[model samples]
Target: MSIRQPVSVKFILTEQTKQQILTEQRRQIEQLTAEMDQIEQQGKLALEQAMTQGGSAAQEVRQQIEQERNQRMEQREQLIQQIQQIQQIQQLELGTELQNMTVETMVDVNVGDDWGMVLMGSEIIIKDGIVHEIRRGGQPV
Candidate 1:
């Protein structure tokens, strides 16, 4: 990616941070999917009610329901785009192991090591005086 204006940063790479970001993005995607499903159910219920009523009022309600469903579909599409963006960021993060030294910032960040980047919305935790344990994450092959 390209930065609008270049600024130097130092970044630290960690497995936990990557997983956290992926989890959050997945949560948002799930939430959006649920909302879309709800919208479909609501539209169906409205149409069903209008059908049972059967008249000019029913016609008007049907038209309104169709309009509302269209709007909800648009919202779902936007949510899908958001999920794609998150996936793109995830891939970018995985491609490079950011450790230290200087490089122009690709995006906004709250980096905590000599810091090339932590990207926006990421945090680095500091434990108060204890044994620091660093090891590989995930299951054994």
Candidate 2:
């Protein structure tokens, strides 16, 4: 029988990869800031439109806008922290491994197979956006 298993995909950190990460993270921060600004403008317009309805209606709109603002703020903070972390990664020596993502692979499981070895999982080491090596059972394959 064959079953799906998760394999670890790791990156061997290089200057190129670091810069790519930093660039992507900074882009996200810019996008978040723009969204926050647009939200504020829309909220102000909404408040003006709701004012004629009644106090309660405007209050509800205010609350909803506040909630949206809070969520976006939290997301922006998280991105900032990630940017800091990437900066720290920049300080690390080249070729250090970083966990990139997980992917599933199919493995053949036969009767009497050593379950531990069967489920040991695998890892693909990437360098400069290329697959450098693969390991299974902690040994290069």
Candidate 3:
């Protein structure tokens, strides 16, 4: 039988990787800022229209817009924090491994298989967009 397993993907810190991460983070920040601005403009127009129609309706619309704005603000803050963390990572010595993401793979299972080893999971170390090493149970494979 075949079983699915989760594996961790880690990155070995390098100058190139650091800059790539920073670029992506900054792009996300820009997108969020643009979205926030768009929301403000659209909300203001809608609110004004509602106000002309009814005061109570306008108040409700304003609340909804505020809620959406708050959500965007929180997301922006988180992205900023991630950018800061990436900057800190740059200060670490090269080859320092940081968990980047996760992926799934399939493994063939048979009777009497070592469950401990099979379930121990795996990790792939990447450097400069290439696979540097693969480890299973903390041992290079």
Worst 10 residues of 1 by lDDT: 132-141
Per-residue lDDT of 2-113 in model 2, one digit per residue for the tens? 9999999999999899999999999999999999999999999999999989999999999989999999999999999999999899999998999999999998889998
- Candidate 1, residues 1-141, lDDT tens digits: the string is 333433222233345545665676667667767766786788778768877878776788767767766776676677678667656656664324343233343443343532333232122222222212322111111
Which 10 consecutive residues of model 3 have the lowest summed lDDT? 86-95
Candidate 2 residue spans exceeding 4 A from truth: 111-114
The candidate, 1 or 2, that scores higher on lDDT is: 2
Best by lDDT: 2
- The alpha-carbon lDDT assigned to residue 103 of candidate 1 equals 32
Please give the lDDT score at residue 106 for candidate 2: 91
lDDT of 3: 0.92
lDDT of each: 0.52, 0.93, 0.92
Pairs with steric clashes in candidate 2: none
- TM-score of every model versus the real structure: 0.44, 0.91, 0.88
**Pairwise lDDT winner, candidates 2 and 3:** 2
